[model samples]
Target: METTIALYSHDSVGLGHARRNRALAYALAEHLPDRLGGSVRGLLIAGHPDAGRDPLPDGWDWLILPGLTRGPGGTVPRRLGGDAEDLRALRAATARAALTALRPDLLIVDRHPFGIDGEFLPALRDLRAQGCAIVLGLREVLDAPEPAALEWERLGGAEHVADHLDAVWVYGDAQVYDPRLTGELPGALAHLATTTGYLGHGRPPAPRGERRPAGDGGPRAPYLLTVLGGGSDGAELARVAAAAEPPAGHHHLLVTGPQMAEEDIAEVRSIARPGTSVVRSAADVPELIAEASAVVSMAGYNTLAELLVTSTPALVVPRTRRRQEQPRRARALAALGAVTTQGIDTLTPAVVTDWWRQAVATRCDRTGIDLGGLAVVPRLAAELLGHGASTGRATTGHAASGRRAAGRRTASRQEVRAVAV
Candidate 1:
């Protein structure tokens, strides 16, 4: 018997969701066979075209949707020359058709449950009727409580999402950051919530092509590294970090993410000092993160996950743009001493230089946080798929008091606990 899984990422913003799903695909491929007594094959249903750039598991492939770009108010079509509604219908139909043909046994949704503008709702409903075990994969930190709640309301409340999702897998250390405790996750979601730990301490997906190392395709030993995730709104940070000087005898490598504008890339490249390196993207970012003497980066979830899993000192400059997600995340990790943080608005070359001087003097201590999300997810997938309702309803537990309305599926939710290191 063989199992098929479909990983979906709305990707309205950057490649964070796509990268995370890629990592999960790597994890699932590595661990699922041993648990399920068979091989695994999957598709990465990503919104961004570039999501397919990364290498996938042997039997896995990419299904890129018409991309959605984030803006001041909300998301819009990335490139397709049509109105939002037209694109939504097209994407919805495409996703529905693909999932119906695949008939995957398990489906994992990254972050958004219904996807951008409910593009995923039709497919999710279609798959449920086909008996697919669906899980919602959430990052450790959403926005601050109020905004997150409003956003959740916008994305359909717990009951609406739960109708389609079998489980909610949180990809963060509970001890480090619990959305439930912080009200980022409403009480209605408690019965469905399971912390998968941070997804950092796991086998990394192979780069689709050769990774561009800092210099000469090797570790720039003792070099100070700065990474801007996706580079959509990272121009200011890149400019500031590029102007800063590293500690004595240390060079700096600033990676302006692939999504960054060409002009911004050029500007950063033009201003780069002799000892500083500026590149649009790098291969095997995790490899670079592991080898850095100390690091500076944006507080994007994937980047932060990379930073937290290592002992290399890090300084996070959170994005101060529309959403408070980045700022909230940087502050949480900063509170844990996992990484130092600075407001992008207040950031300056003097601050970067000063922070780097002290940061390199000592390595970070991240032993207390849970980092085993990758290993745990396969178990959850297997358990759910194995016990899947013939009717497609999940056996996931209900909230205390069993407040579920009549006709709703309810079962005891099993919580996955993390032992502190």
Candidate 2:
């Protein structure tokens, strides 16, 4: 029999969660057949319609919920123009309906555990009743420790996490930067966690038989690229990078993502040096980064993942307006000589050229960082679902959760909380 899977990524913010789930879906489809001795099918459930644009496994599809945008206390309807509570209920119903029918053998949830407003609670209960293996996938950097604690507390803390999830996959290499050591991930959930390294490397482009994803096809080689991951909060970084001069002999192309305001994008284009290109997006960022002479980008998880796998020299200007996650990550990689860091406040075009000149001259070395997550995750999923064994590092085992497997719990006790952090 073939294994079935479903992934849920809240879409109130940028497409990072959805994109990460899509990448994992492709990786699982490519690798799981051998372990299962058959095939795999998947469904990616997301809040933004843009989630459907990305390619998936041969038989997999997408379920995009009502769009949402961050508001005062939590997420609000992006365009529905209705009450926030009503939209949350609608999204929850849609997800529950889809999963109740799909009955996936495994459910991999990215970031948000209970979904927005506890949307996944009913679906999780439904899947749990059917013995679906539930796993929470988290990016390596989850902001500084203090705020992370309060945020996790809002989500019902470690006890709540344990009550719902069977395992936790931290998508990063602890050797490069460990969240546990800094209390970003609490000790209570440590026993059920697994470090899956970065998911940016080894990600195959456009699933088989699918057309290539939409991008600008990127500029020619020996050129520098500047990109803002989501562009929602990247106006400052976009301006900085747009103002910076490309290396002496190379061209500079600034890609302002779609989420950025139109005025912001226009401003970036206006100030861009003559002969330079400023667009909204690219079809293949990893491919573009591989061919760049050097890259100037904000230090987001997805951006860092793309940087880590290749030998490209990048100058990361972490956004520290709200959280210290990006800055912390940049500093850690800088410590290992993997990449260089610059705070957005003090960064300037002249400083950019100085670093770009030297960085491209000597490409970065990421020899020690783990880049095998695309291969390890399938094995971990198979093992978690009782099909095979883990092929990667188990930061800690699920021995303590043996009791969890013996019982099923509903997430009713935990009131739905805000997911804006």
Candidate 3:
């Protein structure tokens, strides 16, 4: 018989979680049929008010929940306060209603093991009673160890995952780092863990006739592409990048993520230099990265993965106010010489410009860091559906060839582990 998979992604704050889940769903749909003996049906249970605004792949079904939101000026709505008790109640009610309706064979949750408000537990508990296979998918980094430990404990994160989840699928290479590096994993989770390489991003082919506009081709221009993952905390960064004066013949492409306010967008637009192109989000990000001389960005995992794929020289200024995860990721990637890191507090137009100038002149081989994310999706789907490890060999043929061409840079397993943690 065919299997039904329901994915629960609580993307209450930014576009990263939802975008990642959607990419995984698409990959599962594309590969499950050939890997599994039977067909697979998929559904996305998104708990974000803005979920609809995100573009969905064709042939996917979605159910929206009453997701919470942070108010203007990055404040949580006063009416809701930050009380865990009240939030959990609301999340529980929503999850109960959705699960009762879907009755999925497999439930894959993106982060938040206990749900955004602790509401997911009841639904998850009920689903477990009914014999559902549960999996928890975590991104590589979850912020510096101390705070993460406290937060996870207070939120009952470890207990919840151990008691109810069937497996834990960490997206990155576990041989490189363990979850304990970021925070303490409840002892209960040790046996249930599995590493699936990095759950890399998927790459759809460039749309037809989508070449760079006439007169826009040739000897890589001295330009930088500046991006904020969701544009939630990027107004200042965009302004700084826009105001900088580059060397003669230098230019920039500033992509404001979709979440930026209209005023912020206008501000970026007004300050753009003659050679700068300030655009809203575009589907052709990979193409832009491939063509750019260098990239300036916030350190969201998806964006970092894409930058790695292109091996584009980069300057990463991570967002640090609301969430501290980006800064940690930035530090690690910087350690590997994959990109240069600038903390939000010290980022200035002059500093940004100088970094761009230096990055353009640097000769770093970024191929080592590009994890070949797009190729991992099909392989993950095959594994999820009981097929052996056929996906890796198929998708990474080119990457393997490239690695051979570049000559391997061998790091001890211990070094790789230290980097991952």
lDDT of 1 by residue, 1-421 (tens): 6888999998888899999998899999998888778999999999998888777879999999998786566677899866887888988898999987887878899988888888899899877765566788999888889988898788678767777866788898887788889998887675688887889888573455566653445445679898998998899999998988888888888888888999998888887766788877787778788778888899998998887788999888888767788888888888988888888889898999899888888898898988878877777676665521222222336411122321122111111112211
Clashing residue pairs for model 2 = 214-283, 215-282, 215-283
Compose the digit string of candidate 2's lDDT tens values, residues 224-273. Answer: 88878988888888887777776667777787877899999889888887
Best by TM-score: 2
lDDT of each: 0.80, 0.80, 0.66
After superposition, which runs of candidate 2 have C-alpha atoms over 4 Å from their true positions?
206-217, 391-395, 399-421
Candidate 3 residue-wise lDDT, 1-421, digit = tens: 5757778887767767776777677677776667666777777877665555545555567777655666564324224567545665766687678776766666888887766656577888877766565777777777667776776777765665577776666666553445644454545554455555554446443455544432344223766688787787789889988877665677777878777889998998898767777776755666777677788888887787677767678888888886677887787778877788888688888887787777776545655543544455445444533454543333234223322322221123224437646
Q: Rank the candidates by lDDT, best first.
A: 1, 2, 3
Q: Estimate TM-scores for all models.
A: 0.89, 0.91, 0.79
Q: What is the lDDT of residue 84 in candidate 3?
A: 42
